[model samples]
Target chain A: DARVTQTPRHKVTEMGQEVTMRCQPILGHNTVFWYRQTMMQGLELLAYFRNRAPLDDSGMPKDRFSAEMPDATLATLKIQPSEPRDSAVYFCASGLVRGTGASSYNSPLHFGNGTRLTVT
Target chain B: DQQVKQNSPSLSVQEGRISILNCDYTNSMFDYFLWYKKYPAEGPTFLISISSIKDKNEDGRFTVFLNKSAKHLSLHIVPSQPGDSAVYFCAAIAYNNNDMRFGAGTRLTVKP
Candidate 1:
């Protein structure tokens, strides 16, 4: 089955550590999105890339969090000097959009099992 | 500020009854809306969606109703089942924007 795959289902690290989460999107899907879920914040968009180029990362903390797609199949989110506040479930989703038209709104995102991050 | 809002944090319903979950949006630019279901440790799954042009969409026992004038929407599950218990999130995409803003999910428990 074509499903988005995420590595390291769970991660535990001390504060000030660098943590990385990886995602392999479904083949042929050009849109990939990263989201953080927490008890306080149900779910917040961290970043998104279209056609392997980042379309927006405005929601991300520029000083600590960074996301990139090294290749079509591999997208990564890294946190440098991870803080305790960064503890949350990180999810990766992918979808296909045709051109720059409004039809992109109709494309439903397919999500992967998330990475549960714990920063102590 | 949160563009989408689910005022109710949790809800409980008896099985075989109707369960209604409400959502409100502040952005008038939103042209598409979607509902997602999530369980512990798993990612959210797309349940149903409606366009700004439509007021209602139904799939199986799940129905979504949109009141564009009120900037509100709702998901109704008839004959609610225990298996339907989960967190439901409301999301919307603005016109010409693919960024989907999500509301704080509402946890629903269907008691048998």
Candidate 2:
């Protein structure tokens, strides 16, 4: 079965370390989203890309967080000089819109298992 | 500010009973709502969804009811089972935006 795949299912890093998470969306899926989940915040959408172009990153912290979709299959979320407050499970989801052309933005997201990041 | 809220942190239901989980949204622009079930260490899975135009939508044993005027929605699971025990998150998507806002989630425990 096709599914969104994420690397480093678990990551542990000290404060001020650079953390990078990678995702491989299902083949041909046109929309990719990155979300962070924590006990305090629940699930927050950090960034989203449609057709390998970022549509929104306003939810992301501008100074340390960055997300990108280099190509159709690859999407990445990076935190430079990550802080302890950034510790959370990061999820990647992919989907294609229904009846509105080939974009995933209009469809329900299919999620990956997620990367559990713990910054000490 | 939290756009979506699931006030109850947890709920316990007996097997074969109906389980009701509620959600509230602050944004009137939210036109589509969804319920997602999550197991530990796994991503949330889509369970049911409803559009603002409809009052209710049902699929098998799962039914989602929407109250557009009240900005409220709920998920009903009939004959709750042990396998149904998991965290349920309520998500809302604005009519004009693709971003989906989620609630803090309610942990449902179905006892035998």
Candidate 3:
């Protein structure tokens, strides 16, 4: 079955280290989303891209966190100078929206097993 | 600020009974809502969804209800089974905006 695939199921890094998480969305999916889950905050949307173009990154920390869709099949979320507070499970999800219409936006997302990131 | 909120952190119901999980949102721009089920160490999976224009949607044993005036929605599972126990997340999406927001999930437990 087709599913979104994420690399490095787990990652451990120290302060000031850089961490990169990769995702391969299902073929033909047009949207990719990145989210962070923590005990206190639940699932927080960091960014999303549609048609390989970044649509929203307002939820992300611009100074340290960056998300990019290098191509249709590959999406990446990177963090530099990671901090302890950044420790959380990051999830990558993909969905197909047929058009800009309201009904098409109802498509549900398919998520990949998340990358558990622990910054010490 | 969290636009979506699942007030209850957890819920428990006996098998064969009904389990209801509620969610409330502050943003009126949201035109669609969804419920997702998540097991430990696994990604959240889509469960059910309801459009703002409709009051309810049902599929098999799962049903979703929406109250646009109250900015609230709920998921109901009839004949709750042990296998149905998991974290339920409520999410919302706005028209023309693919930025989906999620609420803190509610852990559901079904006892035999």
Candidate 4:
């Protein structure tokens, strides 16, 4: 079965270092999303893309976080000068959104295993 | 501020009993709702979903109930099994937007 794939299952870095997480969405899926799960915040949507175009990144921290879909198959989430507070399990999800009218809806996302980041 | 909320942090249920997990949303614009199940060290898996047009949807032993007027939704698992123990998250998508908002999740422990 097809599935979203994420790399670097775990990462540990010193505060102020850069952390990068990568995801390969399921084939034929046009939408990609990035989420972070923390003990306090739970699951938070950081950004999303549709057709390789960013739909929104308002949920992400403008100063340190950036998300991009460089190509249909590759999506990335990067945090520069990462801080301990930024540590969390980052998840990548993808879906093929379709439908219209009463039937219109975003398809359920297929999530990757996630990247566990630890900043000390 | 979280638009979707799962107030309960954890739940314990005996095996073979019914397990109910609840979620609430504040946005009336939200017309689609979903339930995701996550195991430790794994990604959340799509369990089931319900559209605004329908109040309920079912897949096998899993059932989802949506109350539009009350802005509430719930997932019910009948004959809960030990393998069913996991963290469950509630997600919502607005009719006008494709962004999906998620709740804090409720960890369910099925005692065998």
Candidate 5:
């Protein structure tokens, strides 16, 4: 029953407040991804970490959003001065990406239940 | 720009019938594609995937078809079940790239 775990399934805070979402990836998986889903934007990649190393985070807002993999199992996304525009369901996913030139480089990601954040 | 696109926002099918969900991508560099299913208040789950080198892939009751020339892909479910009703998302992976782009998604309703 191993799966990606996300905490604080729901959150509500006033504008300008800081919000932190945590994820515990499935053990042994080396890749972690963060995504934001909203009605207007659909689903978008916020960032991802591979081998505990940040890979592509260009999709994330540099000034307001930050994502980090402090350890292999723990990945975190933090939003400072959270705004109503940032309210959305944040998902964390993990997978074992095959090394380069492995025929298949992208491994299917297993996502967690997600954290629903509301900035009122 | 939307690299991946699910043109139809929603689709409906009667139970025990065939269900087809289509997705199109504009990125020629995309080398792999994946389909995911998501229910309300939950994360998207991986359903199936296919590599650019292959035209089709199948498992049990699900099958995926890819058309590289057209940059189109489709998911087919035979004997659609009530439980199969969910939002389906289309995703594409570029070569040697870890950043995956996703389509808006299509909501599928299977009537019993």
Candidate 6:
């Protein structure tokens, strides 16, 4: 079956280090989303892209976090000078919905296994 | 502020019994709701979803109920099995919005 693929299933980094996470969305999917899951905040949407263009990144920390969709198959979330609070599981999800208009009401997301990042 | 909330941190039930998990949302704009099951070290998997137009939706042993007036939703699993034990999350999507909000998960344990 097709699935969203993520790289570096686990990452361990020291504070102030730069961390990069990559995702390859399911083939033919046009929407990609990045999420972070932690015990305290639960699941939070950091950013999302539609048709290789970013629609929103308001949930991400503007100073240190950046998310990019360089191409249809590649999406990346990077944290420069990462902090301990950044430790969490990062998940990438893709859907067939090109937009949230009337025609895409039933579109559902398919998630990747996620990359567990631990910042010390 | 938390738009979606799952107050119960955990729940336990015996096998073959019914398990009920509740979720509440503050945003009336949220017209679509979904439930997801997650295991340790794995991503949350989509289980069931309900739209505000309908009050209830059922698939096999899983049933989801939505109360638009109260801005609440719930999931009920009948005849719970040992394999049903996992973390359950409630998610809400605003109408015509690409963003979806999620609540703190509730862990369920089904005992034999």
DockQ of each model vs. true complex: 0.62, 0.52, 0.65, 0.57, 0.58, 0.61
Which residue segments of model 2 deviate by more than 4 Å?
A98-107
Q: After superposition, how far is residue B19 of candidate 1 from its true place, in Å?
A: 0.8
Per model, how many backbone clashes are there?
0, 1, 0, 0, 0, 0
lDDT per residue for candidate 6 within B1-112, as digits (tens), equals: 7899999989999999999999999987788899999998888899999888899999999999998998989999998999999999999888777787889889999999
TM-score of chain A of 1: 0.94
Candidate 3 CAPRI level: medium
TM-score of each: 0.97, 0.95, 0.96, 0.96, 0.95, 0.97
What interface RMSD does candidate 4 have? 2.5
- Candidate 4's displacement at residue B51, Å, is 1.2
Q: For residues B3-104, could you state the per-residue lDDT of candidate 1 as single tens digits?
A: 899999999999999999999999998988899999988889999999889999999999999999999999999989999999999998887678888898
Please give, for every candidate in the order listed, the TM-score of chain B alone compared with the true chain B.
0.99, 0.99, 0.98, 0.98, 0.98, 0.98
For residues B1-112, could you state the per-residue lDDT of candidate 3 as single tens digits? 8999998999999999999999999988899899999998889999998888899999999999999999999999998999999999999988777778999999999999
A-chain TM-score per prediction?
0.94, 0.91, 0.94, 0.93, 0.93, 0.94
Q: Which stretches of candidate 4 lie over 4 Å from their true place?
A: A99-106
Model 4: per-residue Cα lDDT over B1-112, one tens digit each: 8999999999999999999999999988888888999999999998999889999999999999999989999999998999999999999888777888999999999999
Evaluated at residue B96, the lDDT of candidate 3 is 72
Error of 5 at B67 (Å): 0.8
Task: Give the TM-score (vs. native) of candidate 6.
Answer: 0.97
Q: Chain B in candidate 2 has what TM-score?
A: 0.99
The whole-model lDDT of each prediction reads 0.92, 0.89, 0.92, 0.91, 0.90, 0.90
- Consecutive 10-residue window with the lowest summed lDDT within model 6 chain A: A98-107
Give all candidate RMSDs, comma-separated: 1.2, 2.1, 1.2, 1.5, 1.5, 1.2
Q: What is the Å distance of residue B8 in model 3 from its true position? A: 0.9
Once fitted onto the true fold, the runs of candidate 1 whose alpha carbons sit more than 4 angstroms away are A99-102
Model 5 agreement with the true structure over B1-112: per-residue lDDT tens digits:
6889998999999999999999999988888889999999899998999989999999988999999999999999998999999999999988867667889999999999
